[model samples]
Target: MANALCDTRHISYAGCVAQTFLFVFLMSAEYSVLTIMSYDRYVAICKPLHYGTLMDSRACATMAAAAWASGVLNALLHTANTFSLPFCQGNAVDQFFCEIPQILKLSCSNSYLREVGLIFCSVLVLFGCFVFIVVSYVQIFRAVLKMPSEQGRHKAFSTCLPHLAVVSLFVTTGFFANLRPPSISSPSLDLVVSFLYSVVPPTFNPIIYSMRNQELRDAVRKMMSWPHFSRHKLLFCLYI
Candidate 1:
């Protein structure tokens, strides 16, 4: 993007294609990771006895690898279908990024139908993951309710709340951006929704998790204090 700006918005054909492919790939991978993280939490809170075994390091790595593979396949499918369309409407994209919804606007023919098919398939997969997350959380909530101690229930809710919030933001913005009717697709709306789907969750997730998590907060504090502690130790050493 900085290069685009520096070159006065002269994005090369290859750059455009790469940007669109990466946009879909990274977004899909991120949402998948969030879904997996939710399931990990569900196991930790609702099935504590088996959590360690179920989400061992090997399992975590496998799940992460699957998410990346799925994201790449989905992005390749969309990218191929998208570029196959003749851009009779011209090369101009109204948005800052090269997403399917905006790129489809420039198609010269109705050849975008193939891309729509891919979009439908993608939506189905995303909705399935959403449903899975919802079901997992439902089970988690039920278990939290049955906890004998109020503090235990509170801790569980605290841990789950950030994940739920991030998921809702991610799914809602993505749905609006991809699923909006063409008649209602104004530049302003597209820009706003694109920002939400593309930028918000990536920036927000870590902040939400770190600020809400006690362990993460403590680790951050320790990290921040290390330099000061070292400085003090050096002064004490000189005095000694």
Candidate 2:
């Protein structure tokens, strides 16, 4: 309510615009991406034999498109609900970011309608993806457990380990924060939750999946050797 405290009367249209853009972008990028990972596991586990055929480049692209559209639409509803109310008396916004509840707190309007709508939208979109991810992994976990070969189980879990960890962290922190009372949400708790939601997943994803892959490591070594060979007298002469 910086604007209100300073006696400015309304929420800045520009600020709302910026916040809407960020909310939409983050929803589409991070949250929807989690669905793709979940669907991928479904393909790999539920239809392993057909995964190659079912998830060809075009099919994967289409799935990604669908997920992006869903996330975008969901965010639109939330953003519209958030800014739809008129704020006449006060203009103090809450949170470091445009988190839904924070915006809800700032408005003077009877917030029940928007709050209910926000809860409904959040449950449908975020919790929906979360449920699918959980079910997909439960099946995957079962399948991995049932594999006759230890190697199979190890391989399956290894591929899923990073995603499973990321999903758990995101969902758990978010769920607790949303479920808990406002009085319970402190800066330290929010900071840790934010890190789990945003930073940890991006940091671990590539390194977890790609770094230890033998094929990639071998390609790197091969490329390095090729440069050395090219620098040798005969190879250099041939290159010249």
Candidate 3:
């Protein structure tokens, strides 16, 4: 972005804003998927007996709202720095996207406060929240494992495995990219890591959900075949 805008390959202000919004969308998508998966785990483990009652439509809607709320808050905070100040002096952004730190460097204004906000929010949401979720799932797995039946154990493992994988990969790469290593902070590295984070959620989410869910597949097949079966029955009734 910095290079492209500096050499007139692309514009910088809009580039930064676009990058921020993309991050917002990605985070929102991740949070939505993870929250629903968490609730699914919650039902499968914590409230096995009353899973239907607890995780009905309303509960799912609430979880989605919470996830979207976080995304909106994050976007608002990140974007505030972009349009808040006049950056006509030097508007070169040194990353593929409009990240707070990289954008702050080009600002002719003081960036101390923005830097602090970025640091705090990064740890609070990315690391802190993820750690909490990991700990919660650990307890959930322990509880699920205590069930005596083989069928129950298989089900529990299937439900929890995909979430654990996604969370671990997300945290590891995202954290590494944010650790502020001088070498890795270059525009090239930033672009590469940005792509990695951007591509991960969409690629892995469907695979995880589909592979882990056999019953959902069966149900779809049955629904599709039901119409055919009904037509056959009507023809037989007319003949009889």
Best by lDDT: 1
Question: lDDT value for candidate 1?
Answer: 0.88
Task: Tell me the tens digit of each residue's lDDT in model 1 across 119-233.
Answer: 9988899999999999999999999999999999999998888888889888888888777788997788879888888898788878977798688889978975798887997
Error of 1 at 18 (Å): 0.6
**Model 3 Cα shift for residue 214 (angstroms):** 4.7
| Model 3: pairs clashing at backbone N, Cα or C within 3 Å | 2-93
lDDT of each: 0.88, 0.71, 0.70
Model 2 accuracy (lDDT, Cα):
0.71
lDDT of 3 by residue, 85-155 (tens): 65655666665456666666665767547656776765676655676677778778788778889898887
lDDT of 3 at 182: 80
Pairs of residues at least 3 apart in sequence or in different chains that clash in candidate 2: 1-91, 1-92, 1-93
Instruction: Name the candidate, 1 or 2, with the larger TM-score value.
Output: 1
